[model samples]
Target: MGKATGFMDFKRQKGKEQPPLQRLKDFGEYTSRLEDEELSKQGARCMDCGTPFCHMGIEIRGMAAGCPIQNVIPEWNDLVYKGQWKEALQRLQMTNNFPEFTGRVCPAPCEGSCTLAISDPAVAIKSIERSIIDKGFENGWITARIPKTRSNYRVAVVGSGPAGLAAADQLNQQGHRVTVLERADRAGGLLMYGIPNMKLDKYIVKRRVDLLAEEGITFLLNTEVGKDITHAQLKETYDAIILCVGSTVQRVLHMEGSDAQGVIPAMDYLNGTTQSLLDGVTAPINTKNKHIIVIGGGDTGADCVATALRQGAKSVHQFGKHPALPKKRAADQPWPADPQVYKLDYAYEEAAAKFGSDPREYCIQTTKIVASSNGKLKELHTIQMDKITNDEGYIYFEEVPGTEKVWPVDFVFVAIGFDGVEQSIGEHFGVKVLNNRLYATMKNYETNTAGVFAAGDARRGQSLIVWAIREGREVAAQVHGFLEEKNIKALA
Candidate 1:
């Protein structure tokens, strides 16, 4: 859709970021967008291949291969390249409900599977996307389009995360009276709390929530569904109930002295910091001048490292059970698959700039925690391990013989990931749950309850925000069809 040979003419360029050490002083977003000229060049790099897999939205070897929402990526890239920004925004919104959110936080599986990535660097699709939306906002071209007609249906959406917000937006646009229920004090569930402000500012979330409200969606905040109201009550009020309660059950460390006072869950640490920032109060847990250890080697672990660095941590280390990833795609991860490659993440860069070395300790496993005589955190005992692959294609960890070590640590943050959706929410709604996920068939998203449905992480287990958005859109269509077939009408 762009120039025929633009990929060859223009090399890939990326957005700018604040210097790592300098940005460590505050929690503001360090990244800045590229100017229009550069962004246009980036867009021009879209080769518009005959078989574009950038928007295929499929999975290979259990890894996302493209845009999960099936974004019309090449079309928007061409629009941006042609300087038709408003049209680009239109194309982006056609598939994605919240481009701003995904642009800021998504891993951009689309880029990973870009045809150009098979040879040269992929087009800067994520940066182009963020610029398009940001420009739309800056030009005041984006506004609320309140539905002109109101329907006789009411939809009560539980949870205000990405999935719930997407469903509410779709249903409200269809003229259904939609209400979003959030247990948190604010609307944007994980966006508002689970994520740190440095990555996604709370103002951005509030701005969108305000826009949604203008479009006739009601947000009931600081209200838990089971504790504040009953399922029967919701069914009596709304024509259909859609559960988007995200998978929030965090996993914890289980070992000797694992319950030490200074150990904390990764989400708790992130949420506390964000809430305190918004409320203008002290964070509940302080890391200033304290030696910190974070368990788990995922994005959450990196976030913990960054948070600790900003909070004036004396020293920081991240422990991961897995070995370091290869610099290039391995044999198992072929073309179009999201390659598990190694790169210095922002947190690692900042830590290295300040501490003179990377903070990650790969192939390490924590065995136990040692508490002081006063029952405070004292030391952490760990051992290094080697990765072993058996003939049956099974992988396992075998401990090294002489790598046992101990370090004096003051705090520990567990970032290993989540268990699943909170079971209590499902039990309250009378929905059957298996493997800690709400049991909804892929065919229709309908639960055992007649008028109730489930989607997003609650139904699919832990997943990316894009997947959640896709499910939200799909479930809204399903709910609309079900209501039409039943001929359900609001009673006066």
Candidate 2:
């Protein structure tokens, strides 16, 4: 620990963000960076517990408990507290290949598992991490670590999201020639389109992409394998292929009038908006002057609400099938587990500031969508649901009688979570899908097909960016081992 009584001495400080109204005017990062002194003070709060559960990346009951990348949180925090920023950056990058991305967007499970968080606030790990990396970039300490020699092994990584990018970075460092193929016109997958620029600027994504290019990783944008390039060709050209294609298929509500013209998937809506902004064209899915309804209350749903509000929507409402969580951790949920507590996200705050009320409506189910004469969605018929548990460990919800209501809406965004990977990509590689409707994975993320593997949302279903990066690094290690074993066999 930096200071014996640091946790007691200093209060938890978070990064400041621009006012919601001002930030909505343009597409740029809103979070302001903490000053050097402030960051050091925050770093001093790290207790450096005896067990240090913050770095223990374990899964309990199917949920991640700590930092998935296993970042040396305390080590880096101590380094930062001592004013050794250069050393701190190096320590931060030892496990996380892309702290820049995770620092800004990751929910920071490390903080949740921090020992101090049992009673007091957790260490400002995420902010310290962001500061360390930003300092590295500003000081020119961050640079491409190009391989000195080539292994003469070629690897193909499909999808240029965090998982694919991490895999390519590791493979390139191991002296193997790595190529990334992205279906979109640009790389960064969800980073490029799914998330709004205000949260994670596209330029930041491009900055990292450019650095990877300099490190000898080949990025083939708009060249989708199995479509533009055949599976046979990929197998013949590369020694191994890693599929990082994320879960792009969005789930839908099979309610009445679901096929209306105004109904669209959340990814489609976000993609259209980002692409239009990138191309300097009028947004294709404009919510301007429209009453919008977003069905789902996850991050994607919040994103939809924020995007609509930014596009000058007359009004926006977000509906969630599940009831709202408690403001504090529930009695059953103890420390070291990610608590299901209610916290206002950026998008929700923006909506509330502008509209004078939170846009979210919890425990409401959409029974039917009402469409106008043109077959466009105009309103949503919904009913309140009561949660109840029955025998045999089954959970069910019942619609409350006489609680039906119609919400006026001109545009409807289905923000329900993804079902699984797109069928075309998986079918092309002959990947086996399990009962969960997600890609089947072995210990190292390898699929049934030889010389082929998978990772990220493609393998584990839709998840956090931190999980994607963890899988990416794990798959890279597996690929390296496979290649090494093959080389040894050839020599024998």
Write model 2 residue lDDT over 160-270, tens digit each, in one string: 999999999999999999999998998999988988888888988999999999999999988978879988999999989999999888898797899998999998999
What candidate 1 gets wrong by more than 4 Å, as runs, is 436-438, 488-492
Q: Clash totals for all models, in order? A: 0, 0
Q: Candidate 2: misplaced stretches above 4 Å?
A: 391-393
| Highest lDDT model number | 1
Lowest lDDT 10-mer window, candidate 1?
Answer: 483-492
Error at 248, model 1, angstroms = 0.6
| Predicted candidate 1 versus true structure: per-residue lDDT over 182-258, tens digit per residue | 99999999999988888888999999999999999999998899999889899899989999998888999989998
Backbone clashes in candidate 2 total: 0
- The alpha-carbon deviation from the true structure for residue 173 of candidate 1, after best TM-score superposition, in angstroms, is 0.7
Pairs that collide, model 1? none
Q: Give all candidates' CA lDDT scores.
A: 0.91, 0.90
